[model samples]
Target: MAVTATLTSTERQIGIAISAGLAILGLAMAAVAKTGPMALHGGMALVLGIALVFYLGGALYDHPEPTNRRHAEYYDAPTRFGIVMTLIWAVAGMGVGVWLAALMYWPEATPAVPWTSYGRLRPVHTSGVIFGFGGNALIATSFYVLQRTSRTRLADAVSPWFVLIGFNLFCLWAATGYVMGQTQSKEYAEPEWYADLWLVLVWVTYFVVYIRTLARRAEPHIYVANWYYMAFILVVAMLHIVNNLALPVTWGAGESFTIWSGVQDAMIQWWYGHNAVAFFLTAGFLGMLYYFLPVRAQRPIWSYRLSILSFWGIVFFYMWAGSHHLHYTALPYWVQTLGMTFSVMLLVPSWASAGNAIATLNGAWDKVRDDATLRFMFVAAVFYGLSTFEGSFLAIRPINSLSHFTDWTVGHVHSGTLGWVAMIVFGAIYSLVPKLWGRDDMAWPKAVEWHFWLAIAGTLIYVVSLWNAGITQGLMWRAYDEGGALSYSFIESVEAMLPYYAARTLGGGLFLAGAFLCTVNCRATMRAAGDRVDEADRPLATQPAE
Candidate 1:
């Protein structure tokens, strides 16, 4: 007879209380919701609440110890959950993105369905990828990085789970609410007041958990990665709170009015929008790069001091560059110049960080050739450099005049997102999954090569097509006949985009295909047999960082 493992009495009590509280809250929200979307989201919360009860309750009755218990030093369960969530959302988000691309060419495909319309689904794709996929990856990897770099267990068992579950709940609410036409109308901050509040709670808890863990660090000096991660958390909290300042019509109502108006509102929104790209997208992932790239390459970072300089440099400069988004607007010219200047200056730190990552792989050329995962990271660093350079150029008032409202901007964003952000994330996932599963490598290593080629080809096709499209659109719009009259109608520009849109859609399809392959490969890797515990899995006390 096998012994049944169970949670302690304290753990069981806490689990039950949280479950019960969520259940009651869900039911209350469901009852109070007068709108269809609100009610549907309430029902989802209720179902999740009930599911948690069963899951926690069952764990108290019977729990199976992990098969590879010998390496019980790190808290890897949450990271694993995060990795799975990242891949799942990657597929869903990119799937929507691909659909949106298709709709650009064939708006008649979905016709009258409000839910499937491009207008609403655009937020779904953006929020889904930015928050759902990238956000989850950040949180998950942050936890792993914090523990290993800090050389301590997570601050508390329950808090990690709470942050993960609560954060995902917020994402779910945001996605579903968007589809149901419940939004606050803020780009990247579109989730309604309720969801925003929920995120606050989760984010605060994440910060507390992180700080507490750092306090318990076994190492004397905090690693450089933690600095970037800390900045990401703190800065995001500050940005989220400030930009989302709004007054809900009522406690029961879904709508809210932002406090800032006119020029102030535009300034605030772009400030938040640009920084969302900075902290949420860039900082957290840079932390991942600082740690994973070197570790996988088996090389020390080329310059610790340079990394420190670049980190602060980025944090300071990025804050001011948001105003570049307001160029050629009614905003004051001085502020516009300020934004453009800082944006140009930002190229230094951005390239420094990228160069540092690439430089770390200097003597590891053999690994880059042999390890597809490392190659992915290497390519990500290159793209980071390339995208940052493009961003700097685009921020110049002269260039912004041409690029603004053009597909060129879209191409630049995808260059960073598809080329830099998602690539590094995929590399991290591939590096992490096998380690977490107690395996030596992925179940299908060759498939990583396949995924890489597909991603590269897709990104190139998408970016190049949009670049040409945007430049052509800009030139055509600016062109004039000898009489100085407009040379082309807006419809002409729109018609010219047809071929490019088709190519972009094809590109997105390929990227989505790569993500799907990643999912399948990860699933197989997790299921593969490799129960032997290794040094990486040993407890924190036994496995201290060198």
Candidate 2:
């Protein structure tokens, strides 16, 4: 029989009643739909919040009273679920990303329909990476990191599954809503309020689970990486809630409008925007760096103090850097200047992190040649270093003037996304899958080698074409004849980009093809492992009689 212990009658009763109550609330709200999108969204949030309360109540009751083995098993189900989902979604999310990149080069590639347009696909791409890709990594890694760092299992399995499965379902809703032309149009907070509220409930439970697990920790000193991870999760939840304040169209229906308008909206959006990068992309990944670098290289972190300093520095400076996105716009000039200055200041902490990762690998150069996983991460750190420096440069007012709305911005984002974020995800997945599956044999080892080279080539071709195209477009837009008339028509710039666009399409195609191979290899590896480790990978039931 299966070891199903986490779920009790009282919990189930509570969950049912709660779901009914939320259903009633949602119907009542939808009945009064004329109130406006914001009101509708608020009403929907109320429903989701209530349903989550029900689930939590049940989860609490169903959880087994602690036994030594039971306590250790508390974390296994959720962690394994999250690990599996991360591997699966990493491929799915990246596939969407590859599609989105190609569309940039071929505007006509996406049909002119509302759902298929650039606006919608752009959010789909962003949501997939940030939420589908990055979000799952955080979930899977945090569970693993927390267990190892705290020297304890998760607080409870039931709630953790709710958090992982629940969060991914929310990602599904948001991505589909976008492709279906449902959105709130806020940068990084594009999910309509209804969707956003679902995330909030899932995340709060995530926080609770994390804290409860910490309470059970065997270790006295919390690992530094966990500190960074916790802050990222907590802060991003706050940022997501505050910045996504909105009006909704209906409950269970995804539609909403952000509260902020004009300059204020721009400020709020980017404030959340930059920090999403700071905390979500950078900080969480830093935790990965700490664990993987040390574990892979067989060395301690370079300096604990440097990690602390960099963490606080990035947090303090980055919140103010979003206004740099609004430079030369209606956002207050002083705010823009502050953002620019802070962006420069932000570089120190960012580099401090980069320096730490690179330094951790200092004496392990020989290891880099044979280990593909370490190679991916080592190169990712180098790209992270380069991208941060480039970010600070572009945040400058003059540079922003040249780069804004051009392909240069596109190139920059891909450098960080494909070059940094995706590389780390690749490494983390490689690290997680084997251990979780307990298989010595990877389905196809050489396929991994081929996949890595293909990704590198794709990323290079994709970014370089955009860079060349961006500079050309930026220059052409500014040029004028001596007669004070236009030197080139808008169509002229479009015509000039055809060759570069074709090159970009080819690059993105290669990336997509490689992702397909990865998915196949992963599936085959799972099949090869079969049931042997599925049982072993779980928590043990009893101690041996000694």
Candidate 3:
């Protein structure tokens, strides 16, 4: 359905005006940049804005004005659109990731072009998956959770679109800019000054929409899911603005330099990087798990106090844990110790959240056994527990010595991302897709079962291969002969990785296939649109107001 079909004439006009303003902004940027990635990006934005303006404008006169009853129903068109974008990014991002994984052992496959080089495409895979795929899931689910928990509709029709569409534009800019060699060279925060500024606008609007909706909520007590979602938004904004504190060489150019230097720069980067893991990857999805897992199992959260405890624990402990990444470096020893200590402390809350999720399924084992959707969630909780424990262990100074700079670190990250984050997302997508489209179940229920197994096998293969590869690299690098000389050449370690690299590539391919299957399943489900709309699916508010 067209977004404008649900909007009142006033809302449609607002959308058109916003679209026009965006077109003007893009045109201005294109005119100023004239040539280069910035110009091309501006042109893309111009096309997008023009298309939206035409879409909204075309519907403005053609569609009947929406009634006050819209205020009674939950705003869902934006959620539907966000889900579509989420799948698109899942394919694009994971496809690039599988390609990068293959390129590791098959270096000859990399194209001679600058953009296809490992350096450029690496961030494309990272940002594309993290921001594009993961971020969209968070936003879409947050909108859905916010309305249901609050018992109110979104504050306005327009802001949700602005947030989702604007955020996707930022993702597009990040990926395309990386391909065009426009980056600040910061990990995770790669997009340069203009994109950073654009995100600030988008993020603030998201926060405002969230707050406004809560203000109109009929529920007296805020849900725990919102707590995590709120943390995700607020902390990410703080992290983004701080880590991306850079001065651009020129207003129109997509080049810039960060403000921090030396050890301070390293400290700042990881502070943002690790916390991006904590808040962006962990917290937002905990919110997802909190909502979707229990709902799928038909259970209340096992422990409310435990939920609050874990939230505060994560919030307090994670901030100090980033320095562990800098252990044995030029960073102060005490700082590294502090980070390690906090990381260890983090396990209590991390496990609390994970355990809380699992415990919620106290009587739902049968459901988990029979339903692929619930199984996706149950497995996610297990991985979440295991990965967080491994993280704490790896943060220890002695352990970091062995694991640091190894593929073990890579394995750990994917364990959390693929095993925990992606699992929960797929679970949520499975659970949400059928409901959102008024379906009793997925169009291909068996496809979901296939996806679950593929994902599990893929994660195990990818993570376990990397684990062996990292340990081998670490052991070989530190090995000594009887003469106290290095026993193995670095090339030998590189050669040893060939088999593991191939294994991981295959693993990643399997995961990608499952994700692709999921996308297809969702497409089919949406198209089917089974006739089973829940009459109760709406705002509880009786009067019409934003």
* Candidate number achieving the greatest lDDT relative to the actual structure: 3
State model 1's lDDT.
0.88
Q: Kindly list the per-residue Cα lDDT of model 1 for residues 1-546, writing each as its tens digit.
A: 111132344555586778778777777777887566667777787888888887777676565443333234777778888988999999999999999999999988987867887778999999989988999999999999998897777766667778888888988898989888888888899998878888999999999999988887878888998999999999999999999999988767677899999999999998999999999999999999998998899899999999999999999999999999999888899999999999999999999999999889998999999998998999999999999999999999999999999999999999999999999999999989998888889999999999999999999999999999999999989999999999999999999999999999999999999999999999999878487566654435433221
Pairwise lDDT winner, candidates 2 and 3: 3
* Alpha-carbon deviation at 33 in model 2, angstroms: 7.4
The C-alpha stretches of model 1 lying farther than 4 A from their native spots are 1-7, 64-72, 536-546
Q: All models: lDDT?
A: 0.88, 0.75, 0.94
7-97: candidate 3 lDDT, tens digit per residue: 8889899999999998988898899888988888888889999999989888888788888778888988888999999999999999999
Which digits, one per residue and each the tens of the lDDT, describe model 2 over residues 1-546?
121344344534545555565556555656654454434543554567576666555465455644455443425555556656765666777676667667766767787687777777777778777888788878888888887777666665556666775688677767776776667777777777666777898899999988877776777888888888888889899789879988764443456667788889888889899889888888888888778777877888888899989988987888889899998988888999999999999889989988998898888999887777777788788889988998999999998898888888888887887788777777776766666566764678787777788778888898899899999999998899999888999999988988888888777777767766776877778666644343333322232111
TM-score of each: 0.96, 0.86, 0.99
Model 1 clashing residue pairs (backbone): 73-539
Model 2 Cα RMSD, 1 decimal: 5.0
Order the candidates by lDDT, highest first — what do you get? 3, 1, 2
Clashing pairs in 3: none
- Evaluated at residue 397, the lDDT of candidate 1 is 98
